[model samples]
Target: MSFIGIDLGTSSVKAVLVDDRQRVLATAARELTITRPAPLWSEQAPADWVAATLETLRRLKDTAPEAFRRCAGIGLSGQMHGAVLLDARDEPLRPCILWNDGRATAECAEIETGEPASRAITGNIAMPGFTAPKLLWVRKHEPDIFRRTRKVLLPKAYLRLVLTGDAIEEMSDASGTLWLDTGRRDWSDRMLAATGLDRSHMPALVEGSQAAGRMRPELARELGFDAPPLFAGGAGDNAAGAVGLGAVDPGSSFLSLGTSGVLWRTTAGFEPRAGSAVHAFCHALPGRWHQMSVHLSAAASLSWWSSMSGQSEAALLGELGGQIDRPSPVIFTPYLSGERTPHNDPQLRAGFLGLGHDTDRKAMTRAVLEGVAFAFRDGKEALEDGTSPIGEAMAIGGGARSDTWLAILADVLNLPLRRYRQAEAGAAFGAARLARLACTGESPEAVCAPPSGEADIFRPHPDRAAAYAERHALWRRAAEVSHALR
Candidate 1:
């Protein structure tokens, strides 16, 4: 039997078909647009997501009708922290407020004032990217819509509701909304009181691998399949990526370099960082939690630099490859779109420090790579608390495609970086693995195994590690200066 995994991302909806042995059979994607009618506000029509999902599934059916018909189960993974409000009739009241939209900063501030109690109750600090603040924003500004709201769901959960008609969310995705009791794996009553919402407005919570429902007969027919079992409640994109990369075990970790960059570490129990810098979320793996450090601009920064300079990422890396032997004094702060972990400041901006006449494009490029590494290190230190050192971390996404960047990351992290054989498909592949486990009643390890590839291990050189440590201190100082100036 084959399994289908659907990743409903911020920019597109992607569907992948994988065989029982975990080999991808067919893939399809449909891009969707985010509308910004006003500054700092981002929205997407829920109908648009449904339409794209349908079209993407249609493409998958067209690609291999026989394989599509043999699909045994379907799983979903999507962007986290987006708010999708539904009316009593289950119709969306308005366009979803996306994860990137920052209009709820004021509400975030209000929630933070009660941080001590909030953290005790929700196991997280309020952030504009979370769902509660966005919900409050809707409640305060769009009262009529708020009154009509019957269900509050995340991006993927909304899609899951449409797919399964169950109106439920998984614990992994719930952890991102700042409304979940991370320790208990349930919605926080304190958060509900603070937000002036009731528990009834939220969807029932399920474990990541639990079967939510069967595919709607209509959707099944559309995809040329019988009613396949639907595992609608999978996980947030990051957690799903971890599942994809086989980073489900404690001490297993991975770095994702997608639109956002993240350093994910799986742990057995809840280990909340004293400071709310790192996000502690429920992992897709049963009874496990993951701590994450996020960089808002990871691959995005590289993309911007490459696009502005009219250089392909490969070309830029090729140019910088020559300068790796020579150290440059320049240091870049990868806060182009502000920052997430370590420093939760959105007003902060990217900057270049130690630049001089001798600084060249190659040096600048190196700084960009190291800067992101430094940010990751900052988050690592905050989350580590001298508890457990990450033994090895798998690398995925576009940034991992570069050996030089991997070297920089390995040196800065001072840990072995293992490049996955199947790169850039972490989320989709993970969803398929989860679907397999759900359908077959097998352990994740039995269903998912690390792919065999040429291993490129980067060990830290003592000298470079020391140099990076020094540069990290300077980077922290620069962040303080930048924040003050703002």
Candidate 2:
């Protein structure tokens, strides 16, 4: 049988069709737009998500009719920490506040002060990206909408509601809401109270790998389905990507160079870092936990450079690859959208130091790449220095497409990195695996198997490692001083 995996990503909603053998049969994507009504605020209309899903599924049906008809289950993965408020009729009260929105900085500080137990329970630093702070921002700034909010759901859960008429919030995604107790894999009463929210505003929780609900029969038939497919409790995009990359086993880890970069490792039990930058959250599968160190911008810095320079990524990188003979004298800090991980400060801004008359577009490009690499090194060091030590990691996402960047990353962290076959399929492929487990009762180990084959390997260069080590140290000291000045 075939299964469908729908991933509600920030830029688009992607749907993948996979057979029982875990081979992707067909895929579809619909682009989405993020609206910024004000600086540091990101919003997306919930109705657009529903429309995107339907359009994507329709495309899947039209493109691969046989695979679509044989579909046995559905799974969902989405951008985490988004707040979708619903009124009494289950209609969205307003556009969702996304994971990257930084307007809630003051609200995050409020949460840290009012809810001292937050870190102990959620196992996360109170960053403005989390849902609790966004809610607090709404409560303080838009009280009327806060009062009308009868339900709070993440982006994928809102899509799940439209598909199955059920309000399902999976564990892995909910863990990022700052309202869940990561150790218990459930919502914390105290956390809810801290946000002036209650159980009534929350959805029924489900394990990330378990079945959430079945598709409504009428809706299934209208979509030209042969049966009402079982809907699985899919994970957050990072965990889903881990499953796709076969990083479920303890100690298995990956470094994703997406819009926001993350270094995550799987563990057998919860390991909360009381005052560290590490984030402890439940894994997609039950009985397992994962820790993450996040950097708010990774490939995004490159995107910014490309846009500002009017150079395509390929052109910029092509120019950049030729400059390996020497390191750029400039040092850049990639705090363009503020930062998380080691420095939980949102007001921090990005800057470049040591620019001279000779500095050109190519030097600036290399500096931008080097800056993100250093930020990633910061996270990797935080994780390795903490309870979890990462020896190696699978490299995935848009930046992973750059051999030069990945090589730079390898030396910066001095860690071996592997790229897997079908690495670009990412979260949607893993969501499809979750769908198989939910419907066919297949073990995660069997369904979410490690990469059937290896594609590439990147190892550190000793001389470059030493050079980057010195530069990285300088970056940390300079960043501290810059943050202080900010």
Candidate 3:
């Protein structure tokens, strides 16, 4: 039998076909575009997500026709916290509000005010990027749409609804909504009422590895499958990525450097430290939880600079040659899309300092890399919290491909970074593991093993750690300056 995993990402939709042996036989993807109608608002039409996902699946099937026909389970993973409101007819009421959208700053405070213990209940501070606050924003600014919203789903759950004809969500994704009692792994009525919502508006909840429903028969036939495959309750993208990495054991940790950056660690039990702006949420597997320090921009900063400078990331990175022994004199703040984790300031903006006439493209590029490293260092410190120290972590994401950036990251955080084979497969592969578990009823431990291969470890350069520390202090000062810009 084979399994399929689909990752609905911010910039694209990716689908991977994995056989029973856990090998990824084929993969396909389609790019997606975000609409920013206003300065702080980001959105995407729900139809675009459906279209991209379908096209990617078609491509995957075309690439490996026999494996596609043998697929026994399907799993979904997607960008977390996106608010997709649906009406009585299950039609989108408006474009989906995205995780990076900062239009709900006021509503975040409103949610905290309405539910005084929201932080305790959800195990996460209310942020503009979370799903619940986005709903509150819709209520106040787009009243008619909110009034018509009979159902609310996260990005993947909406996609699941289209595939299975059932509205289902899993613990990992629900934990980001500010309505779930994360410690209890369920929804909190008080948190719902804080946003004037009720259970009726929420999807049926399930563990990420459990079977939620089967794919619709007609859709399965159209895709050339013999029977409708069982659908697994997949996870929020980070949790799904963690699943893919087999980082389920307590104390296991990793860093994700995709569009957003995350320093994640699995926990033995519920651990809430909202005061530090660290996110505590349920893991995809049952009886597991995790903590994360997330920065809204990581590779995104590089992409932005690349676009503005008319230079490809490859060309710009090539200018630096390799890892430098000293820090860039220039310092950059990676708050291009506001920020989260340690700051949670939606109005904070990105900036660069210490630029001189002598500064060239190489210096600026090196600064961009170092600036992101500093941000990850801040996240590392936040995750420390007197316990749960991360001795080393596996690196996974598009940005992790850069040896220079990884070397800088290792030095700045003074921690070892490991790279695995197929790390780039990421969340989609993890979702496929969930699909296999759902179909086979296998123990997560038996199925979610780490990939087979010797790993590459990037050890920090002791000689350069002190210099990076000094530069990190300067970066902190720059971030403080950015806080005042709004």
Candidate 4:
């Protein structure tokens, strides 16, 4: 039996095919567009995600028909916390509000004010990026649409509806909704009521590796499948990425730099650390949980700089290797879309500080990269109060392709970093692994064991790590003053 995993990302949808032996057979992806109708609004047509999923699956089939021939299960992972409302007939009520949209800041505050035990229930801070705030925003602003909404779905779960005609949500993905009780691994009634919703609006809950539904018969035939594929409940991008990197047990950690940067570590038990703004969410695996520290903008900031300066990100980072005497004097705060790890402020904007006459394109580029690295360190510090200590963390994401950035990350965190063969295949690959676990009765430990290939390891430089220790302290204080820009 073979399994397929689809990841509905912020910028694209990726479908990956893997065999029973757990080796990747084929993979496909399709880019998506984000619509910004207002200053802080980011949305995408829910149909776009479906179209991309189908097209990517078609591409995967074309790439390796043999893999699809014996496909047994399909899993879904996606950008977490996007609110997709459906009417009575299951049609979308509006464009899907994405995870990065900050329009619901006021609504987030309202939820916190209304629900006094929010932190205890959700194990997260009230933020605009959460799904419940978007729901509140709709109920207050678009009452007509809100009144007609019958079901609310997350990004990838919407595909589950079209593929299997099932309305289901997995715990790992739903944990970010600000309505889920992280400690209980279920929806919190108080939190849902805070958003003007209840259990009726929520979908059937399942664990990430549990079976959700069977494939829709008509669509299964159209895709030339002999039997209905088992739909495995999937996870959010961060949790799915952890699976892909084999970070499924306690002390297993990874540093992920996607559209956003995440420092995720899996734990054996559910521990809520909302006091420090640390996100404690249900792990994709059952009876397990994870702590997350997020930096809202990572590669997105580099992309922005690449567009602003005429050099490609690769061309700019291509110049940053070799020995460095000291860190760049030009300090850049890569908070283009605000921040989430410690401050949780949605209005903070980035800036370039300590600019000198000698500051050229390379220094500015290094500053941008180092600044994001600093943000990651800030996240690590926030998680310092936790019980677990991360050993060597795996590095995966678009930014991880840059060796200089990885070196900076290792040095700043004072930990070794490992780069694997599947750096580009993040969440989709993990979803496929979850699919395998569901299709077969293999334990997560058996399915997501140690790495097969010899991974390249980068160790921290002692001197640079010491320098960053001091610089990060300054960067921390700067973040406070920089909040004035809000």
Poorly placed runs, candidate 2 (over 4 Å): none
lDDT of 3 at 233: 97
TM-score of 2: 0.97
Candidate ranking under lDDT, highest first, comes to: 3, 2, 4, 1
Ordered by TM-score, highest first, the candidates read 3, 4, 2, 1
lDDT leader = 3
Candidate 3 residues 1-486, lDDT tens each? 999999999999999999988989999999999999999999999899999998988998899999999899999999999999999999999999999999999999999988899998998999999999999888998899999999999999999999889999999999998999999999899999999899999999999999999999999999899899999999999999999999999999999999999999999899998988999999999999999999999999999889988999999999888868899888899999988989999898998899898988888888888888999999999999788579999999999999999999999999999999876799999999999999999999998887679988899998898889987887898989998897
The candidate 2 region of ten consecutive residues with least summed lDDT is 319-328
- Model 1 C-alpha RMSD vs. true structure (Å) is 2.2
Candidate 1: stretches off by over 4 Å: 112-116, 274-276, 354-360
Give the clashing residue pairs of candidate 1, or none: 244-430
lDDT for 375 in candidate 4 is 94
lDDT of 1 by residue, 332-381 (tens): 88877677787776666788888888877888888888888888888777
State candidate 3's TM-score: 0.99
- lDDT of each candidate versus the true structure: 0.81, 0.88, 0.93, 0.88
Better of 1 and 3 by lDDT: 3
TM-score top scorer: 3
